[model samples]
Target chain A: MASSPTTLRLAVCLFDQVTALDYQGPIEILGFLDPNNVKPDVPTPSYLLEITYLARTLEPIKATAGPRALADRTYDEVGDGEQFDLILVPGGQGARPEKVPSSLLEFLKRQAPGAKHVLSVCTGSWILARAGLLQGKKATTNKSVFKAVVENIHGYGIDWIPKARFVVNDDKKIWTSSGVTAGMDMANAFLEYLVGKEAALRIRGIVELSAKEEGDDEFAEYYHLL
Target chain B: MASSPTTLRLAVCLFDQVTALDYQGPIEILGFLDPNNVKPDVPTPSYLLEITYLARTLEPIKATAGPRALADRTYDEVGDGEQFDLILVPGGQGARPEKVPSSLLEFLKRQAPGAKHVLSVCTGSWILARAGLLQGKKATTNKSVFKAVVENIHGYGIDWIPKARFVVNDDKKIWTSSGVTAGMDMANAFLEYLVGKEAALRIRGIVELSAKEEGDDEFAEYYHLL
Candidate 1:
């Protein structure tokens, strides 16, 4: 049954003071798609995901929330020749600052254009926006920092939605989700789109995520983002 | 607020090929309680939690799913006197083998008893059981590996529940959850129990977790574990 073999290259951007859940939520829900994470008895046939953790530096950087992660490659190393199919940028207190890292912004600006899909969780969109990539793009951000993001990124000419758990630009294939846990919801939906509803549901069943929905979030109302 | 001071020490155990989400989900949810993660505008009044990551070796260990993390301390370094208020053990492909490392089992055996709360996510319960910790206790494991867990650890006399997302022996303060994302749900419930519903709800609102519930799991039916 195997026909043409393809490898999906995913770049998970890491940085100092990153939020653990924003990136982790998406990685957890979607990480299984990495063919390397296979079940021995289940007969998955084959694996197709090739993940690389990219950061500005090679050193281990601690997130503001907790947990220090080591990047597999630096942005400069993955600079020119290498390109990705998917780029996932997760936000946190680090992204909350007005002066975001130049290297990070430059990396996103450089690599995101060539990728098939550019996804951001929470404030990561702010990074993409700072890179000038989200200009004329529809996106959303963490509600806890709702006003801050809405206020800060207005200069980029991006259309920021107030009440979405996530927003997608069908034309650009750029997906952005609200706060920490909301990324998981968005990821579950993205998985449904990437593989098929049946496969996504199969994954949700294993994780026991019965209540995850595409737009079933309440933070917009709770935080008065709407 | 200045009248009294208190600190809660938490120890998160890490291992080779550990699932990043399993450890990260709980860390993300609970990391906020660690006073250092305070928001200046939020006025949390004061900080009170200290976290330490413990592993068999000080070197970075790669999660079976993805991401490499650094442990704060080696298990040998965190000797008998260094007790913790909470101990979290997350499971992964690493825990599936019959012969897990003796040091990790030894560390859990030595440290968990002294903790106010001992929690395991997904197959981490298997490690707790393997350490001879969950005997005569109610617990659960990853539904995908349900038969493996039920078959492997039956001799330990654990009351393995098939349907619950998470099960806790209130008196013992032992909490165990199903697979992967179930850890986030368990963490939300635990936050509610720890800091009161209002505070937990506040945290949940920030993260925008809509479907995180203690018993809101469906893996048993999906996996045919029941």
Candidate 2:
């Protein structure tokens, strides 16, 4: 990586009934990965992120809440040959295996395998597991449904940690986080890993927000992640 | 209020170049306030929040980032005769006085005065101040550019606090927060103030996220907010 790698193309998955924060929180944090949003004073990172919202179509994907994000392109549009630098998948009530669109699963299987980084927020990890990308990798998911989701998806050779804030599989190039807002924390950790502490610190400073390692995760105990 | 207020109308303003998380974070947190997203197992709050995205037009309001959210109605369509239970204002680089649309100022002037709650996230407080809504009221804005923005809009009778995470003016029904993501903390604090601690705690538990009172804003000091 040079002082800046010029551009890092990102493919962000959007879907109906998606939990908006799962992806939105991390997306905002990762926006700092874009060089265009950089300030002159901040120590520049090695790459700039250019995000493209991907869905089944170009229409607005309705989130579980009233909020909706208009997709920039469809899964088919990317084609099997198109390789993204990063792939971000978010989760919601609609993320259940029975409810997820086949196109989304097929798209993930094709793109995520070759992407530089594959990140999943909340139950999005479940989707990645479904796509066979989580096999032989360490990952985590939304704890509220962690046991049910992980148990249902067992036998994939994946190490599922219910009490983790986020688990990174540098070997597999996969990063998975617990629950919704935890995505923000994972994004921060992943950004620091890729872009260095100086860049990550600048973003947190500007936003008056923190991206920290919150491993206590009381929900794990409450939900009995066993 | 009573055992449960039943319904609470919300007007969330969206615009081109708006910081998505400024409003998105709040919207996700407040989704619990709406009856539709509530689960029977999770304890319900006293009221249900009904949100309506109000923009300059009914078109898709583009965020500075790649995401875009469609507006449910327009400012002109909201009309002064219609009063919202709450008015949520989000900010971005485009939120400056010279850049904000006149229609937004007109809409705020007409609507915010009568709304049950007037909330501003990030530099959204700057917009409220421009509309004369923050006059003689304690408030804050995005600390990254807080001092300069506050100084530029001086003589609005604004008691701008550079270090505060968020401030509440119960008499004026105004709530202002710092920077982009601080809106979530403010939202958490405001929810507790209005609906009670139990509801706020439950929501935090369910999401497995925490928003703290970060008043000693290091960004304010680093940026020389003094």
Candidate 2 DockQ, CA atoms: 0.63
How much of the true A–B contact set does each candidate keep?
0.81, 0.62
Candidate 1 per-residue C-alpha lDDT over B41-108 given as tens digits, one digit per residue, 9 for 90 to 100: 33252335688988888888878765788888888887676788888889987887554567889888
DockQ of 1: 0.72
Look at candidate 2 and tell me the lDDT of residue A215.
69
What local lDDT does model 2 show for residue B51? Answer: 91
Q: Judge candidate 2 against the unseen true structure and give its global Cα lDDT, from 0 to 1.
A: 0.82
Scored against the true structure, residue B126 in model 1 reaches a CA lDDT of 93
Worst 10 residues of 1 chain A by lDDT: A38-47
TM-score of each: 0.93, 0.95
**Model 2: which residue pairs collide?**
A5-A46, A142-A179, B136-B157
